[model samples]
Target: MNTTKLNPPTQKNRLITMILAMFLGIFGIDRFYLGKWKSGIAKGLTLGGLGIWWFIDGALLLMDAFLHSLGKDSGFVKDARGQDLRLGLSMYRLKDGRLQRDWFSS
Candidate 1:
């Protein structure tokens, strides 16, 4: 039996993905950037589900980015390879106690 594990592919950039989704999401360029070809084609064909899908996609990306910045998992956005995007400006934190911490400000 094989006993080796394969490393996943590199994660995609969140900023670029958000940019594409915000600007060209109607054509599914963001999905193509994430390597989701099938969905990309479908989105493009449907004009981003008559624009509803495009708006939802952009909103989800934004939410994910916000969550990531807070040191949380991205519940909405992920690449085709199932990797989280390199989003958010993770910052230095000051530990208030063993179970407490402050975000952004030191």
Candidate 2:
């Protein structure tokens, strides 16, 4: 059985990510800034999926930020390390092999 190791949330700046996505998302700058190099390259190669991906990413970030501001668990996007950008949900399999829900990250 494989276990998922949970790490604390990363301190990456959401605002900076938003700015990068807004201005240079076509180049995958936002993914690069989040340390997601593989997706970054893919995004770059696809030209942000002909701009659709770019727009979706921006919208997701906006939604994530909006939900976070409401003091809710809202982790629509995570960094390369598999940690949420903010307090959000996590999933894990317990030792007994049951799926467990970790409602928030610190």
Best-matching candidate per lDDT: 1
Model 2 RMSD in angstroms: 9.1
State the local distance difference test value for candidate 2.
0.73
Minimal lDDT window, size 10, model 2: 87-96
lDDT of 1 by residue, 1-106 (tens): 4433465466788778989999999999999999999999999999999999999999988887766666664557888978888755334322232222323222
Which lDDT tens digits does candidate 2 get at residues 42-72?
Answer: 9999999999999999998877766555554
How high is each candidate's TM-score?
0.75, 0.69
| lDDT of prediction 1 | 0.78
- In terms of TM-score, the best-performing candidate is 1
Range of the 10 consecutive residues with the lowest summed lDDT in candidate 1:
93-102
